[model samples]
Target: MRRRTPRVRPAALAFATLFGLADAAAQTSYQSMGRLFTTPSERMMLERQRSDNRAAAAAPATPAGPALPPVPEAAPAPPPAPQRVGGFVRRSDGRATVWVDDEARETTLPRVAPGAPLPVDLGGRNVIIKPGQSYDPSNGTIQDPR
Candidate 1:
């Protein structure tokens, strides 16, 4: 018996030829044709692109007008002086009044609760008084020093 080789059918040959032509055409289309910027048309396109980029990079100039003057800082004001006074509250109504020597001003204190000490300010000194504590307005005494 003699051995014979298998032969490719007509349809198979036509399909192979079609696939080969498609592959060749795809490769030719995808191949790079050097750098596009080397051509004169491409160089003109690049120059226009660079000019647009430069125009964008340049900042817009400010309009000419009157310049704003610098603001001046304000000077600080002086602090107020201290005050001192002396007085006692009435045991019955809890109302008290005091007079300051330095300012020659008199101020009445609000009603204090029972058993609460009375506070007064005169010149720069402060004095507190309990019930039966005598306060001297002339010498600014907290207690009887005699």
Candidate 2:
């Protein structure tokens, strides 16, 4: 028995070639070409910008006004001294006295509250200090113990 091979028809070969070329063209990218070319509107905009830059460069620069005197740089200020005060509590003649700035200031120990303000004199200046708080005589800053 003799074996006969299947033959490809001319119409089938042409159809295959056409479809293959069509698929290849559909898959091909055109981004590089797009970057190389610009639309008419874009070209006009570019030309307008170039003309504006050229006009600005050709125009005469305005004369500068009289130069102002250079400002002198100020020296850095020194750090402020620490504002702190030390006090000691003393009981004399059955009266509570707070010694601040080496002066005795009397206060009612029974009337002083933990959070309430207690009036006291520091260096002849009246200042308020809470029972559980610290007082700064230099700046009159109150610091809560809590």
Candidate 3:
């Protein structure tokens, strides 16, 4: 009696088909006009799409991830007002000219401390001088305290 060869199992054949050589075109999606595609332009377009799909399928896969949030900006600042500074400077004279912020004192005394406050009567009103500041008597300037 002659020995019989064993037939290929259905499961084995199915697995071979499932994991076998894959056609690059099958991996990509493209429009198909089926048997209706007839014109030269349509045929050329279909042929071009086939080539594009083949190239795309051959390329490696890229990783997908979530997007990041945008950052916020700050507002602009304001400019500063003008400032006046400095105290009195006495020269060789009988009356010491005491100057405040900008005004030079008319009533010259014999001696006084460099930054010490001086009392002056402006129209029967007394005014005290401060350091690094001056009083403009001509302009009737009123300086704010720091």
Top candidate on lDDT is 2
Give the per-residue lDDT digits (tens) of candidate 3, residues 1-146. Answer: 99999999999998788765444355443344345777899999999999999999999967576655666666655433323434555668665555443666566654667656656544344666555543455555647556
* TM-score of each prediction: 0.26, 0.26, 0.26
In TM-score terms, candidate 2 sits at: 0.26
lDDT of all predictions: 0.61, 0.63, 0.60
Model 3 has an lDDT value of 0.60
Task: Give the distance in Å from residue 35's predicted Cα in candidate 2 to where it truly belongs.
Answer: 99
lDDT of 2 by residue, 17-103 (tens): 999998777667553345643588888889999999999999998859987799999998864432223443535554676654444
Q: Which stretches of candidate 1 lie over 4 Å from their true place?
A: 32-146
Query: What stretches of model 3 exceed 4 Å from their correct place?
Result: 1-86, 133-145
Kindly give the number of clashing pairs for every candidate. 7, 0, 6
- Local accuracy of candidate 1 as per-residue lDDT tens digits, 21-134: 999988887785555567899889989999999987796867498876878888876544323333343434544444443333444565777657666654345567654455
Question: Candidate 2 overall Cα lDDT vs. reference?
Answer: 0.63
